[model samples]
Structure formats: C-alpha cells, structure tokens
Target: MTDLECRLLVIGGGPGGYVCASRAARMGVDTILVEAGRLGGTCLNIGCIPSKALIHVAALFDTARRQAAGGMQGISVAEPVLDFAAAQEDCAEKVATLRAGVGGLMERSGVKVVQGHAWFRDGKSVEVESETGTLLVRAENVVIATGARPVELPGLPFGGKVLDSAGALALTELPERLAVVGAGYIGLELGTAFARLGSAVTIIEAAARILPQYDDSLTRPVRRRLGDFGIALELNSNVTDWQAREGRLTFQSDGAEQVLETDAVLVTVGRLPNLDGLGVGELALRMTDGFIEIDEHCRTSMRGVYAIGDVTPGEMLAHRAMAQGEIVADIVAGHANGWDRTCVPAVCFTDPEIAVVGLLPGEPSEETVVSQFAFRANGRAVTLGDTEGFVRILARKRDHVILGIQAVGPGVSELVSGFALAIEAGLRVEDIAATIHAHPTLSEALLEAALMQASMANHG
Candidate 1:
C-alpha cells in the first residue's frame, strides 16, 4: 500500500471540492483532491453546463422557427429540424472540454489529483481504493464536497423510457411526447427546452403551480410561455405509477387516470446529498437530514474536517457551493472570512429567462413600494420582436432601500449582476432610477422599474 500526506485532502472533485483544493494549493497548502468519477462532477459533466448548452440550441431553433412563422423579411429558411444526436454530441464534447480544463487547473495549482473512492479512516486520515491499488492519505484538514444526486421516485421505476435529468439529457432521440415529473427549475428548464425542440411536453406538478417557491407574480411570465408552447400542465397532480411498453411510457395521473403515450418520461423532482459509502457515520461528524452539518466556516462537527456544497445545507446552486469553497479555503488559511452574503442570485433558463436576487419569501411590506416595467415598453425588446416579460423592483417605502430585484424576460440572466450589486450595496431605489441606462435597450426596463417605484416615469 502506498502512503501519502498532505495539509488539505478534499474528497469529490465537483465544483466546491475543485475550487477549494485549487485555492488551498495556491495558498501554499499541500492539497490532494480525490474523485471516483469525472473531475468536473455533476454540474459541469451533467447538470448546469450541459443543460445550458441544450437551452441555447433550443433557443436558436425556436427563434428560427418563429422567424419562419412570422415570414420576416430576409429570414427565409426551411422548417427547423432537430438533430438530437448532434445536440447530445455537442453536450458531451463540452463536458469533455470542461473536464480537461478542470484537470489542467488542478495541475497548474500544484494539487495532486487522485482517482479513487475515499473512505474516512479517521478525522484526519482517509483510505482510498484506486485502480492501481490501495493508498492511505494523512492530512491536517479534510473537506467533504461530495455534492448531490437526483432523487428517485419511489413507486415509479426508472428504466427504459423513464429517465432522470441526466438520462434525459443523454437521449439521442427526441421523444414525440415527453412527460416530466416535478415542476421545479430543473423540470421547467429542460421541459421548456424540449418543447422548443418540437417535443409535446407535459409537466406534472404536485404543487398548485409551477415553481412554487417563487412568487406568483414572478412565475406569471413562465406560465404564459408554457401556454405559448401548448405544454400541458397538470398542477395539483400526482404520478401514481409509470410503465413502459413497446418504446412508449404510460403514466397515471390523479383523479381520472388518463393515459398519454410518451416516448420518454423525465423525472426532476429534487436532489439529495451523495453520502453513499462515505462512512461519515464512523466519524464524529453530525448530520442534519442526511446532510453533513457544518458551521458558517464550513467546519464539520469533527475537528479538522469540513463540508461544503450540496452535501451541507441551504441552497443547492452551483455558485453557492463555489462561494462556500472559497470561504473554506480562506478559513483553512487562517483568514477570518465566512460564508455571509446579502444576496445570492438564481436564474432559470426558461423562455423568458427568470433571474432573481434578494427576494424575501413572504409578501412585500405594506410600506414597501413595488413597481414593474414590461418588456413591451422596451424599444430593444420591440426591435428583437421577443417582448414577453417584465422587470420588477421592490423597495422599502420609508428609506427607499432596495429590497429585491426580479426580472422575467429575454436576456435577463445577463442583467442579474446589476440586480445583485444593487441589493448587496444597499442601494436606494432612486439610485438605480437615477443611473443613466442606455436608450432603447433591455436594461432600460430595469431603470423604468426603479423609476416607477419613485412615482416618476421618464418613459412609460
């Protein structure tokens, strides 16, 4: 058995783990990062990046289809045909490129990359089973960034035509009819992509509305887009069972069990921490709901051990995990930084991409003024011929402090930085309204929303 020693040993080479390992190595800490699977983990290899690529392709195809339908001048083209094999190939290539980039980063940072499954021998020691042989690593600090996996439906067996998000992304054949379970961001984003790609998409949600976590006003634009796609939405519905026959999937819904012949069924319910075979119970670490409990500094209950990313708690966004990774690196380097931020932005790549920052879950205060500026009013949106949503701002009535900024429109994802900055800096509504946004642009809606809150409209 080979033996190795390091100052920091990171398990899982996902977003959080890789970032933490690289940062630690740069900070002069001897770091070793071990991964049982691909270096980029789920987000890069399967989840965020690949999904965004598919969304972009679908967006382009949809735009072309719209141009053909509208008979726009100088926009003549044959009906858009989706090459599912090409799309899957493109996703695979992007994942491979990103995986190589991550490997290069590890090498450049002087972080040793170990390919194996690591099991804890103690708080400061790990035993790994590698292809070459067994190896033991002794370290002063350990970071568990094992990340998460998709939650499987209990009764509905996932095989054949029934698939999870990862499997759904890998399909080379576009199903004529697609049934998606769960209406969360994952389901909506992919379902919208598939719908744009000419699949008859139906979303079944146990909740009363899609994106139940988001405010109704914020989700209104998405609902409208869903209608535009002719995508069936069965809200307040549950999937009792699913069976596959002759390359078709049949599912039962609530109340009257109507059957729809589906070429594929995509499941996007949720994700749970990936703690299988990690032997966390053997250590003195505490767990909350199957996730390792960690403090703001990312320290686990056991001394010299820490946890971050989806394996910990809070939001399961990739950026959140990256932020935690940075904080953990800082803490390991004896810095005083912690995971404390006023706002964390989230984006959904639906038809009218939804971006939100610093939004409180409940109703706005009575004194808190809220305002909206529709994309229909924006000259850029008019020129693009894709006016579908609006930008909304919420602020305190007393001090005019910005409470939250939310937008549902084309290219809203690119505008999220400004929203996050406004909330993070505690900027007043007037400050945003006073800023000179360029004329005839999508960003003008942001300025308009802010201006509307101040009871003044430069351009209504």
Candidate 2:
C-alpha cells in the first residue's frame, strides 16, 4: 500500500467534490480528489447536461417538423426526419467536451485527480483503489461528496426492460412506444423529449397531476402542452407489475385496471444518497431521513469531516452542493464562509419551463399582496409563438417587499437569475417597479408584475 498525505481529500469528483478540491487547492491547501467515474459526475456526464442537450436537439427537430407542417406563420416545408444515432453522437461529444473541461479546471487549480474508488480507512483517512494498486490518503480534512443514485421501486428493479434516468438517456434505439412511470420533472422531461422524437409516450403519475410539487396553475399549461404533444398522462395511477415476456405493464388508473404495451419502462420516483460502498457506517456518521446529517457548515458529527451534495439532507441540487462545497473549503482555508441564503431557485425544463424562487405562489398571509402578469401580454412571448404561462409575484401589502417570484413559460428558465438576484438582495416590489425595463421583452413581464403589485402600473 502506498501512503500519501494532503491538506484536503475530497471523495467523489462530482460538482461538490471537484469544486471543494479546486477551491482548497487554490487556497494553498494540498488537495486530492478521487472518483471512480468521469470527473464531471452525474450532472455533467449523464443526468443534467446530456439530457438537456438531447432536449434542445428534440426542440430543434420539433420546430423543423412543425414548420414543415405549416404550424408556424409563413413557414412550410417537408417533414424533417430525426437522426437518432446522430443525435446520440452529438450528445456524447458534448458530454466528453465538458468532462475534459472539468479535468482541465482541476489541473489548472493544482488539485490532483485520482481515478479510483474512495472509501474511509478511518475518520480522517481514505483508501483509494485503482487499477494500479491501493492508495492510502491521509488528510487534515476529508470531505464526502459522493452524491446520490436512482431509487428503485419494489418488484420493478432497474434492469432488462426497466430503466432509470441514466439508462433512459443512454438509449441508442428509440422505443416505438415508451411508458414513463412518474410525472415529476425527470419523468416529464425525458418522457417529453422521447415523445417529441416520434415515440408514442405515456406517463403514469401516482398524484392527480403532473408536477404535484408545483401548484395547479403552474402545471396546467404544461399539462395542456403534453396533450398537444400527443403524450398520454395517467393520473392517480400505479404500475402493479410488468410482464417482461410480452412487454406489457399491468397498471391501475382511475379505479380501473389496464394493460399498456411498450418497449421500455422508465421509473424515476426519486434518488438515494450514495453511501453504500464508502464504509460510511463504520465512520459512525449520523444520518437523517436516509441522508447524511449535516450542519450549516456542511460539517458531519465528526470533527474535520464534511459532507455535501445529494448526500446531505436538503435541496439535492448541483448549485446547492457547489455553494456548500465552496463554503466548506473557505472555512477550512481559514476564511469566513457560512451557509447563508434567503432562498434558491428551481427550474423545470418541460415543454414550457417553470421557475420558482423564495415564497411559494399563493402562500398564505394576511399582509401579503399577490399579482401576476401574463406572457400573453408580452411582445417577446407573442413573437416567439409560445405564450402559455405567466409571472406572479408575492410581496408585502404595506411596504411591497418582494417575498416570492414564480413563472412558467418559454424562456422562463433564463429569467430565474433576475428573480434569484432580486430576492437575494432584498429588493422590494417598488424597487423593481421603479427600475426602467427594456420594452418588448419577457423581462418586462417581471417588471409589470412588480409594478402591478406596487400599484404603480395599470394592469388589465
């Protein structure tokens, strides 16, 4: 066994681990990051990046198809056929480029990247096993950012015809008909992407509606868009069993049992923290609700041990992990950094994107005033020909301090930054209303909503 020493050792080169290692190394701390897979982790390799790349390609192909069918004004042509293999190749190329970039970033930041599986030897020591040999890394601080994995449902484990998000994304051959079992963001996003590429898609949701986390108003337009896309949605549905021999699924919906034949079934209920092969149980780290218990500083119960990302109980988002990683690194580097944020924004890239920050829409309060501005009234949305949602703002009725911002429509994902900034900086509704917004833009809709809430603009 080869023994090594470092100031910091980050296990799992995911967004959190990589960021923390880079920051710590740049701060003059000798850092080493270990990972069994590619450097970019789930978000960059398979989960978010590749999926969005395919989604964007689907959108482009869909636009061409619709234009060929004369769905748009002053546009007509022949049907555009989808090149599935080519699309797959393109996504792979993009993912590889990004993976290399992540490696380059680590190299420039003076962080050593170890291509191996990492597990705990002790509280502050880690053992890395690669193809060459065993590496024992002892550090002043060890951070676990192993992230999470797909959660499997009983009786329908992932394999064969059943697939998780990663499996679904890597599918080279598009199914003639794909049955997606879940209506959350992952299900809808991938399911919709498949449907756009000419697959007969059916979504089965246990809840009454798709995106049950979001209110009805925010999801209604998405529901309609799904219908327009010819994708079937079975609400309050449950998949009882799968008949692999015949490729049929036995499910119950609306109090009736039915059978749906499909080439593949994608189950995306949720994800669980990646703690299994890391010998975390031996470390005696506390767990909460199936995740690692972490404090504001991402500190575990043990001193000098930090955990972040999906392994922690909180928003299992990349940005959240990244921020937490940065904070942990700063604090370890003798800099003042703590977890402090009013709210974080969430975006769903369905047919029409959804963005939410701060207070939830229609959150109950006697002194709160709520107002909305429809995208139908926005010139940019009209020009884009995809006006199906609105931006709503919640603020104090007395002082007009902005509390929450929610929007669903085309390009609303791009507007999340403005909402995030406004809420994070403690900007008021009046402050937004007083600011001059560029005319004929979707951003103006935000200004209009704020102005309407402040009673400064006459809204119809």
Candidate 3:
C-alpha cells in the first residue's frame, strides 16, 4: 500500500471538493482530492448542467412550434422532431470537456488527484480503495464534500421503467407517456423539458400545490403554462406502487387506487446526503437529519475534520457549495474567513423560471411593504411574446429596507444578481425607486415594484 501525506485532503471531487482543493493548492498548500466517480460529480454529469441544456433545447423547440402554428411571416418548417440521442451526446461532450479541464487544473496546481472510494480511518487519516490496492492518506486537515443522491421510495425502487434524475438524463428515446413522481424543482424542470419535447407528462405531488415552498402568486404563471402544455397535475396524490410489464409501467394513485399507464416513471422526490459508505458513524461524528453537522468554518464536531456542500448544508446548491469551498480554503490558509453570506439565491428553470433571494418564511410583519409588477406591463416581455409572470419585492415598511426579491418570468435567472445586490447592500425601496430604469424592458418591473414600495403612483 502506498502512503500519502498532504497539508489538506478533500474527499469527493464535486464542485465543493474541487474548488476547495484548487484554491488551497493555488496558495502553495499541499492538497490532495479523491473521487470515486467523474471529477464534476452529479452537477456536471447528471444534475444542473445537463438538465439546463435539455431545458434550453426544449424551449427552442416550443418557440419554433409556436411560431409555426401562428404562421408568422418568413418562418416555415416541418414538424419539429426531437433527436434525443444527439442531445444526450451534446451534453456528454460538454461534461467530458469540463471534467478534463478540472483534472488539468489539479495537475497544474500540484494537487494530487486520487481515483478511489474513500473511507475515514480517523479524524486525520483516510483509506482509499482503488483497483490496484488500498492507499493511506494522512493530512493535517480534511474536508468532506461527498454531495448527495436521489432519495428512493420503498415500494417503487429504481429499475426497468422507473428511473431517477441521473437515469432519466441518459435516456436516448423519449417515452410517449411519462409520469414524474414529484413536483419539486428537479421533477418540474425535467418534466417540463420532456413535455415540451412531445411527451405527455403527468406530475404527481403529495402536497396541495406545486412548489409549496414558493408563494402562490409566484407559482401562478408556471401553473398556467403547465396547463397550456396539457401536462396533467395530480395534487395531494400518493403513489402506492408501480409495476413494469410488457415494456410499460403502471402505477397506483391515491383515492380509489386509479391506475395510470406510463412508458417511464421519473422519481425526483428529493436528495439525501451520500454519507452511508464513508464510515462516518465509526468516527462518532454528529449528524442531524442525515447530514453532518458543521460550524461556520465548515469544521465538523471532531477536530481536524470539516464538511461542506450538500453533505452539511443549508441550501443544496452548486453555487452555495462553491462559496463554502472558497471560504474553507481561505480558513485553511489562515485567512480567518468563515462561511457567512446575506443572500444565497435559489433558481428553478421551468417554462417561466423562478429566482428568489433572502426570502424568509413566517407571517409577514405589519411593517412589511410588498409590491409587485407583472410582465404584462413590460414592453420587452410583450415583444418577446412571453409575458406571463411577475416580479415581487418585499421590504421593511418603516425604513424601506429591502428584505427579499422573488421573480417568475422568462430569463429571470439572469436577474438574480440584481436582487442579491439589493439584499446584500441593504438598499432601501426608495433607493431603487429613485434609480431610473430603461424603458421598453422587463427590468422596468423592478423599478415599478420599487416605486410601489415607495407609495408613489408611477405606473398603474
């Protein structure tokens, strides 16, 4: 067995792990990163990047179909056909290129990249089992960034016609009738993509509403779009069991035990941290709700050990993980920084995307000022023929301190920076209202919302 020693060792080479390793190595600290699978982990391989690419393709298809149906001048085409194999190949190519780039970065930084399954031997040491043999790694500090996996239900396990987000991304053929088992962000994103690509998609959710975490006003536009697409929604529904027969799957729904015929079932209930095989319990690490508990500096309960990303998370987002990774690297380098940010944005890439920052749960304060402006009033939205959403702002009624910003509209993901900046800088509603916004733009809604917050009758 080979013995390895480093100043910093990061377990699991996902966004969090790779970023921590890269940053520390660049600072001339001896760093080593180990991964059992691809370098980019789930995000690049199966989650965010690939799924967004598919969503973009679906949007383009829908746009083209709408234009053809309207008989718009000079736009002529036959029925749009989806080449699933080509789309999958395109996604794979992009992921491979990114993975190779990550590998190259580690090599250039002199950070050792080990390919194996890592299990903790103790607080400061870990054993990696590789194809050749077991390798021992000892480090002064260790960071666990193993990330998460999709949760599997008891009665309907992943197999044959039933698949998870990862398996769904690898599919080459489109299922004629598809049933998505959850209405969370992942399920809606993938289900919408497939629906736009000509699948009769049905969404089954146990909750009374889709996107229960988001306010009703914010989700109204997306619900309307889903209706326009003929995507059936079964709310407050429970799946009892699923069986595959004759190359098709049938599932039993709640109340009367109705059967639904489906070519494939995509289960996206939620994700849980991948901590089972790491031998963490053996180290006596404190865990809460299946996640490792860590302090602001990403330090675990045990000394010389740290955890970040989805494994020890507030929000399981790639950007959040990246931020935590950078913070941990700084702390490791003796910079004395901790993971503290006022705003971490959450985005959902649906037909009409949703972006939110600094939104808190609870009863609205009596001194809270809320304002909203619809896309129907924006010239740019109307010009794009996609005016079906709105932007809402919440602030302290007394001082107009901007507390939260939520938006649902086309291309709203690109607007998250503005919302985050407002919250981060403690900008008052009057400050945003006084700032002039360009006319004939969707961003005008932001200005209108700000004006409303100021109690000024600017745009009716």
Candidate 4:
C-alpha cells in the first residue's frame, strides 16, 4: 500500500472535480484528482460532447436529405448516404481530443491525476483501489464531484436492446425502429438525431407533453418540428413491459393498452446521483433527496469536505458544476467566495433549440409583465428561412426589470449567454431596448423583445 498526502483531493475527475483540482493547484495548493474512468467523465466521454457531435452530424445529413428530395433556395444535392460507423468514429475522435486537452490542462496546472476508484476511509482520508496496487490518499480538504448516472426504468433494465443515454451513444449500429421512453431533453435530442439518420423513431413520455419543465408555448415549435421529421410522440404514456424475444414494448396510455414493435428501446427518464460503492455510508455524510447536500460554498456538513456537480443540488449542467468548482477553489485558496450568480441558463438542442434563463412565467413574482417577439418578424430569422419560434421576456410590471428570458428558434442556444448577462447585470427592459444590437442578427430579437416589454418595439 502506498500512502500520499495533499492539501486538496477531488474524488472524481469530471468537469467539477478537474476544475476544482486544477484551479486549486494553480493557486499554489497541493491537489490530487482521482477517477476510475476517462478524465472528462460523462459529459465528455458519453454525454454532452458526443451527443452534440452526433446532433451536428444528424443535422448535416438531414439538410442533405432535404436538398435531395427537393432543392432548397436553389441548392440541390444527391440523396446523402449515412456511414454510421464513420460518424461514430468522428465523435470518438472529438471526445479523445478534448479528453487529451483536459489532461494537459491538469498537468500544466500541477494537479496529480490518480487513475483509480476512490472510497472514503474517513472524512479526511480515502483509499483508492488502483490497477497497480492499493493507494491511500490523505488530504485536508476534499471535494465530492462524483456525477450522476442515467435513471433506469424499473421493469426494463439497461442491457442488450435497452440502452441508457451512454449506451445509446456507444451503439455499434443504429436501430431501424427506435423507441425512446422519455420526452426530456436527452430523449428528444437522441431521438431527433436517430430520426434524421433514417431511423423510425417514437418518443414515449410519461408526462403530458414533451419538455414538461418548459411551458407549452416554448415547446410547441419543437413538437411541430418532431412531426416534420416523421417522429412519433407518445405523451401521457407509461411503459409496462418490454419483451426482448418478441421485440415488443407494452405501454398504457389514456386508459388503453398499446404495443410498439421496436428494434431497440432507449430509456432516459432521468438521472440519479452516483453514490453507489463509494463507501460514503461509512462517513455518514448528510444527504438530501439522495444527493450530497452542500451550502453556497459547496461545503458539506462535514468539515473540510465539500460537494459539487450532479452529486449536489441545482441543475445537473456542466457549466453549473464549473461555476461551483471555481467558487470552491477560490475559497480553498484563502480567498472568499460563495454562490451568488443570478441564474443558470438551460439549452435544449432540439429541432428548434430552446434556451431559457432566470424565472419562468408561473414562478412566484409580484406582478410580472410578459412580452414576446416572434422570430418571423426578425429579419435575420426570416433570411435564414427558419422562423418557427419566438423569444419571450418576463419582467417586473412596474420597473420592467428583466426576470426571465425564454426563446425557441433556430440557434437560440447562441443567444443564451447575452440573456444571462442581462439578468446578472440587473438590466431593465429599457436598458436592453436602448442597447444597439447588430442588424440582421438573431440577437436583435432580444432587443426587440425588450422593446416590446418597454412599449417601444421598433420591429415587432
């Protein structure tokens, strides 16, 4: 057994863990990061990065297919053939390149990367079972950045034809008829990609509508686009059973039983915090809703121990984890910091992307004025030939201080940062209205929405 010591030890080499370790180490704190898998964790290895790459490929193929069917804007092309294996290989290459970049960043930042599975020996000590031998690490401060895993359905377990988001990304061959058993972002994203790639995709959602977290208005365009892509949606449905031998999935919907003959089923209902086999039980750490509870500074109940990322509360997003990691790193490096950010933006890369930040419509507010600017009216969107959605801004009725901003349109994901910045800067509707946004750009829609809220819309 080899024993080591550090001022800071991060238990998972994900976005949160690696960020915390590297940032702290650069600040002159001795830090060590341990992981059982790739350095980038789920987001890089199997989740966000690979998924987006697949989505991009799907979009390209879809555009080509459309052009072949009938030329768009005088652009014509032959019916595109999809090489699934090559697409997968490209995604793999992207992940590997990013993974290597992350490793380089850690090395340059002076973070020691230990490849192993680590478990708590005590509050300040951890024992890692590495391939070479048993290694023990003692640290003054520890951050639990162990991320979450995909939640599986009760009856239809993951394996064989049943796949989680990770398993779906690693598929050797795309299923001809795919049944995705969730309507959340993950399900919709993958389902849309497969459909674009020529798979007959059916999305089954237990909720009443797709993207149940968002309001009907924001998701309506997405729903319409799904139909345009020839994908089926089964809302308000519950999967009862799956027969592997018969390739049949049984579900109950609206007091009726239905069956779907699918080549494979991808279940992505949700994700649970990954706390299994970590021996956290021995530490007796406090947990809330099955996740490690932490304060604004990401400090857990245990002294010198902290938690971040999906293992803790808040949205399970890579950017959120990175922000929290920055705060923890600053605090550990003898500076003072806490979570005081105004909002965390969320983006869904659907047919028409959805991006939102700050408060929604129904959230507790004192007399809010909601205003919207349709992309159809925006010159840039009209020129782009995809004007199917709108941007809505919610603000305080009296002061017009922007409370929330929600958008559903083409490439709205790129506009989210500016929306977040506006809220963080406490910009009122008047402020956005007065700002000069570039003409013939999607960002002009934000200004126009604010102008509408301010009752001075120029191009609404």
- The number of the candidate with the highest lDDT is 4
TM-score to native of every candidate shown: 0.96, 0.98, 0.96, 0.99
Cα RMSD to native, each candidate?
1.8, 1.2, 1.8, 0.8
Predicted candidate 3 versus true structure: per-residue lDDT over 18-43, tens digit per residue: 99999999988899999999898899
Query: Could you tell me the lDDT of residue 318 within candidate 2?
Result: 91
lDDT (tens digit, per residue) of candidate 1 on 1-460: 9999998999999999999999989998899999999998899988999999999888888878877786564586777777889988988898899899999999999999999999988888899999999999999999999999988887666777788888888888888989999999999999999999899999988888899988898898899999898899988777766656654434455566666667888989999999998888779988889989988798989999999999987889888888999998888877788867888899998878999998653666457878888999899999988888989888888998998888998999999999999998999988998899998889999999888877687778
C-alpha lDDT values of all predictions? 0.88, 0.90, 0.87, 0.93
Q: Give the residue spans of candidate 4 off by over 4 A.
A: none
Query: Which parts of model 1 have CA positions greater than 4 angstroms off?
Result: 246-254, 361-367
Instruction: Compare candidates 1 and 4 on lDDT and give the better one.
Output: 4
Model 1 whole-model lDDT (C-alpha atoms): 0.88
Clash count list over all predictions: 0, 0, 0, 0
Clashing residue pairs, backbone N/CA/C < 3 A, model 1: none
lDDT, model 2, position 74: 82
For residues 1-460, what per-residue lDDT tens digits would candidate 4 score against the true structure? Answer: 9999999999898898899989999999999999999999999999999999999999999999999998987899988899999999999999999999999999999999999999998999999999999999999999999999998888899999999999999987878999999999999999999999999999999889999988999999999999999999988999998999889999998879999999999999999999898889878688989999899999999999999999998899999999999999999999999999999999999989999999999994499989899999999998999999999999998888899999999999999999999999999999999889999999898988888877678986
What tens digits encode model 2's per-residue C-alpha lDDT throughout 108-184? Answer: 99998888988887888888998889999999999999999998988789998899999989998889989999999
